[model samples]
Target chain A: MRFDVVGLGVSTVDLIFTVDELPGREVVQRAGESVIAGGGPVATALVTLARLGAATSMLDSIGSDFFGSFIQREFTAEGVDTGGLVVAQGRTTSKASILVRKSDGARAITFSPGDAPELTPDEVRVDIIRASKILHLNGRHWDACLHAARLAKEAGVLVSFDGGAHRYTNQHLSILPQVDICIAAHDYAAAFAGTEDVAQAAKALLEAGPCVVVVTQGAAGSRVFSKDGLDFQQQAHRVDRVVDTTGAGDAYHGAFLYGLARGFSLEASASFASAVAALNTRALGGRAALPSLAETEMFLQHPL
Target chain B: MRFDVVGLGVSTVDLIFTVDELPGREVVQRAGESVIAGGGPVATALVTLARLGAATSMLDSIGSDFFGSFIQREFTAEGVDTGGLVVAQGRTTSKASILVRKSDGARAITFSPGDAPELTPDEVRVDIIRASKILHLNGRHWDACLHAARLAKEAGVLVSFDGGAHRYTNQHLSILPQVDICIAAHDYAAAFAGTEDVAQAAKALLEAGPCVVVVTQGAAGSRVFSKDGLDFQQQAHRVDRVVDTTGAGDAYHGAFLYGLARGFSLEASASFASAVAALNTRALGGRAALPSLAETEMFLQHPL
Candidate 1:
């Protein structure tokens, strides 16, 4: 199937419990507003891309379980193609119980990865990768991701990646050479570079091979470091109020990916993505306040 | 404010996700049926008691949050008194995300204790605890539980306890001397006794000061030990099949407490409680298949 962006990763069902603060052991708090929705860096980004008028498709082994059903249904509802998806038998989809602090809208998440079968390299649909303009990835299903990256590279398709807190060091970093554009959360860059400084982290990440590396610092906006020595920074859009920042980073990555597919310049896409991220904080989850292309354009016209 | 039983502990909001098996790290499975209910050792017991036509009330710090509101609303709906409940400011309610295995009905639970304020001795409603015919305790809110037990003792009310797993050894063992009737799951008895044998566990628990100790063994019914040297076994009620056993033990405790209040003999109460536990396993959650007193009595007549 022809596609604009094809994403590969686990789509999690996030059960967000809102509380005043994260509790210590043995402490009990009454939960405030609770939300249940599909979440995961690549999953949310794919949803974001679809929302912004991209013909996106998702490729992952969503187990034949309730959570898998929910993710697959949600993907279809969000206009993401499910033709390339695989349903593994007798497996559970990832479920993340996130505790969102009411005051700062910060969160602590407990992730339960169900025993779904791993997506193998053989499962990578060559035709889907070749037909797709962008093959987006999050560092899960390492072998499958590596295989898809290789196919996308051979097919001359742009290999976009969302380096979200990329903890699987060697596995994730090695795939960077095949990645064309990697928009990462600041923490992911910091971890990848083993440095606290954002600039240094971005520079270190660029050295590892993604030609264009963009590091997103929440509320501080985003910065892009290109191998061609083009460095640009975009200011964050002012938010009227922040309700929940749970999925804002992924929204930024999704919007940024959307921009690249739409053929926008680096600086323009960064600012456009920043606008999308800021507006997303007005709602409870990552997909709650996702703006359309026109809405994002309008948001860019007037800051908040 | 007179009541048949007063319970002291949390009314946890349980999010049960059904999977084929317990997941290992980083695996994903598809979920099957999912259920949400107010559950806890004492809470389920109270719910069972209320369903069986007992005049029940509960005392705890169920904060003014969504889950707390849900529990309080459920209590009011179930005809359980909530007049003595405290709405602690800025606290989150206990949420248990349980993964129920579809194949064997086994479950693995991840409990998140939100930062709700602890219920203190001062918050224990002296009048409510005294007015109740029986006081039920679960090993949470240690100070408040101890205070309520003392009040029940002074008022000559029967103090019945449900020693869940009783992992809090030091805090739990001390509460036993103040307890009158103790009904515990086999696991709790084993933990209390630090032995694998059910008889030894029951005997060991009785020595800690509960005059009556009954240990519930799932599918095997129960064995009761009395300080007066009466030890008797009750056969489990045979069911067509067991669906969910989540709160079967609690149902047994609540039924046993009901039997005593209704003036039944020790042996008769054990059998009656066994009937309640057996019947409760026919549905999705603890409260779903809870039988009315008439239904339970009918089951007792048929012995199933």
Candidate 2:
């Protein structure tokens, strides 16, 4: 099936539990309840996009284990195309256990990516990228990701990299030049640019290779830099209750990609993305709390 | 095959991540490493029994999901018989995601038990319980557990219940009469006895029907009560480091059961269990850091 955007990276099974309060040393607290869901940056972003009425596809590998099947089923349920997903033998897919404190939306996470299967360039379906308007990646699988980005560029498709961190070695840095737009956490941007200021970090990042660079500064909002100069600073929509910040960044990326694919201007798209992200923090986990298009628009018109 | 002990309860796949410190608000920390292994009370106990050279079998249900398969694989790999395990159709099994804070071995856990399959008395192979010297239940399956306890009692097998919590309404009170030995946490004992003092809680629990009652008091050690009157108190072994307390209780229960199966005296078993538990807290997770028989014996001799 053809897609507007396809995401490539890890997908995981998340175990979430809620506690009344975080206890001190030697103190025990009773957990209220628990839930299981699909998690991971690219996977969650794709789910967010699909929920926002975008035709999304996920290209990743999962183990043949129970959590792997859980992830596959969730993707199917979310109406995401899993045609590109490969089930590996002799390994269990990634899993995360998250503890949410009730007083605040703070969470403690533990995860196991049990020998995550590697995807090579040969496995990248050129036709899929060729048909897509944008190819989004989450900064893993550097070699294959570079190949995919190269293929997308050749196919006249825009490529965006969700630079979560700089775990990539010098070898992986070679792929940065092929990326068109780079979006990342402020810390990641600072680390990449070797500067602490968001504006300076954004400029350094754009100079690194990408035509445009965006640094998300949590509640301080976001800043974008391009050759055309800095765009207007967008403030985050004030949220009444911050239930969770688990997938706020993923929501922003997904909504931004959705806006870009739908022909929205850079400023408008960033504002729209920020609204969706703020709305997501009102609930638990990442994807479960994503707002609908109507909700996002309403939030923009009459924000909390 | 004839067995020395049989465990009936829920088995889980644990996703464990170890971080250098507790993450602050909006702060992200890199994980040092991660490990995936089998978890849950009965699951760990059976694995411990198998490791201690006892023939063991786990009677439980798992979801047909990927996580279930992971749990099954772990049990089989550990040499615990899986013949009695039923895979529930169209159900996702229980999973736990745990974060181990490196600074203090403290852990935050999130768990999801999706449509846990139930084991019925009719599904029990009579000979398996009859041939066993002890039958252990973790109070996960209330009705089925009660039935199994009755069957074991009728066949002259000693029945033990690992009362993790007071989950089964008032119905669990009925099963208490059939239980020969009750091992539980201080909180659970308090809830069951309607009091906070561990010694008083044990006395009240003993009156509820079990011939013996043991209540673990975390770092304070444990209190034991019996029909023959209260036995000696067992103190917690001093450890230089306490890594993650995630499965320390389960380790204590497992080692305590192992001692009972080996015909150790009540006082000796409690001491052995305390030593094993202290050694387990020396690392992280349940089965991942389990001490060997020799290691536990040495710790018991050295008293730390």
Candidate 3:
């Protein structure tokens, strides 16, 4: 495989503001800090992998607006290949205005799904998927995602699925059988399994398809289970300060995949992923505090 | 005078999003609607006057960023002159991310005041202020606002001051004596007068040097008082729905000045201003629903 991971998902520009308090009514308040960064479930995950020295390519359609340019530029800066990306003319790119409260890193988001047309099945980069060791997706661009998953499976490339919080639906079941690795937020796991029980939800998801299943509960930590009788708990790493947890889970997914691609043990992989996720919360945006491969290794060794 | 009004204030790009609910914790929600428009106290006010067929010029220092360009483009599109706008190379323009809840037009704003240098007294555009029928200010650029007010006063141009909600200060007292008309939010009036009584606040504001004083209370209506014994209550016009009130007060100030410029009686001006402010709330942003003179006249003839 030419690339380490190839991702198919929506790309968005996040305008994250660190405010003193979440406003309840009509009021104008100054931001403590502001950051504009590229964000999306798979897009941010791919960036995390790239920042960890993995070669990754993005697959999606974005607008030709200033935000589109910003998204592409950010990917390029982070060493993420955009060869499979499409730019729709005169369209608006997806954007999210996120207000994170300074006290606790809690956030309220308002997103505009831009008018850029979704990537069609024909627009899927078959060659890119076939050349990657793994294909990552978050269920955006339904047709294109399904098409890419089948293509990756056919090519013997590992297919990874990220079930973000509040992003699960009945339609996801059809794609699950093709997904080789499934990582989900606890919310997605419960909704998908129709059970709030963590172990039961993991078992149900494992029975559906993927050899491995991980259920992430923010701060409390994460649980990993595999069909081959592997099970463990990965404690959430403590940080001096969690400035924003906007993309912590995404970081974990990317780092976990990086561990697999590097042939690490499941235990080592989860530990590395946990460290990466913890480090990412040091800044105000999703990818602002992404640590490089060496930094992650040093952090893992130091156990921060 | 070559211009009807000259304004000295900061200009900003407002990214307004209408969401189902303001998020209290970490959550992503789609916006019901979104709008990108120019916003500022004096900036929106000038756009209001220009839309109503008054010649207006804006004087401020904005950045050389995309937002700065948007601000200038908006001003030009609204027929407000931009000859006095100084584009500070490579600096960022002020920006506000506003989330307005759908159920109510209540807004939560996170503003990033850009690094654009404030306009100095030398950049006051004296000729523009002298050429205008009215010099409008909201105490943004301290030195420049003071310089322009004195210049307008010296040239026999009427001086108008807008004391926005929570925007009053002792520094404003120095500029008040030069002002001929003062329109203030109830909050500003109370702060300035150290009293919550509407009548007393208006009287105190009038004594500060403006021959005329108008104290505005959102949704409740506004009270107008002049040193010459003209007093009246301008009731708030009822609209079918209030989309967003981001620029309602600014609209009122602009329309009132437009009335004065068109030589309408004080009562007629307040009535016209009230209608304009109500109409402005019919849209999501500050300038989206600004009405022309004909529209205002028609609304006055048959109000909702």
Clashing pairs in 2: A65-B66, A66-B65, A66-B66, A66-B67, A67-B66, A67-B67, A97-B97, B105-B243
Compose the digit string of candidate 2's lDDT tens values, residues B1-304: 8888889998887767787655433234446667667788888878877766778888888888777888888888778888888888888777665666676666655566667667877877677888788888877776678889999999999898887854425567988888888888887888887889877888888888899898888898988889789666889887788776667777788788889888899999898888877777766667766777887787777773
Of 1 and 3, the candidate ahead on DockQ is 3
Candidate 3, A53-113: lDDT as tens digits: 9999999999997688888988998999999999999998999898888877778788999
- The better-scoring model by lDDT among 2 and 3 is 3
Top lDDT model: 3
Q: Write the per-residue lDDT of candidate 1 for residues B1-304, one digit (tens) a residue.
A: 5798999988777876666655433233456765557888788888888999999999988766566777888899899999889997767777776666677776655566666887899989898988899999987888888888888898899898887754437678778988999888788888777898987888888888899999878787789999888898898887778888888888898888988988999999898888888899987776778899999988878763
Residue B48 accuracy (lDDT) in model 1: 88
* Error at B178, model 2, angstroms: 3.8
Q: Candidate 1: which stretches are off by over 4 Å? A: A25-29, A166-168, B1-13, B16-246, B253-269, B275-304
Instruction: Give lDDT for model 1.
Output: 0.82
List, residue by residue over B1-304, the lDDT tens digit for candidate 3: 4999999999998888988776656776899887778999999999999999999999999999767887887899889999999999999899989888888667778899989999999987888888899999999989988888888888999999999998989999899999999999999999999999999998998888999999999899899999998888999998888888879999999999999998999998999999999999888898899998899889889987
Top DockQ prediction, candidate number = 3
**What is each candidate's DockQ, to 2 decimals?**
0.05, 0.18, 0.49
Whole-model lDDT values for every prediction: 0.82, 0.79, 0.91
For candidate 1, write residues A1-304 as lDDT tens digits.
5788899987878877666655423233556766568998888888888889999888888778666877887898999988878898977777766666677655655566777877899987788888899999987888999999999999999998888764537678679999999888888888887887877988887788788999888878888989888888888888888888878888888888788888998888888888888888888876888888898898888774
Model 3 per-residue lDDT at A32: 80
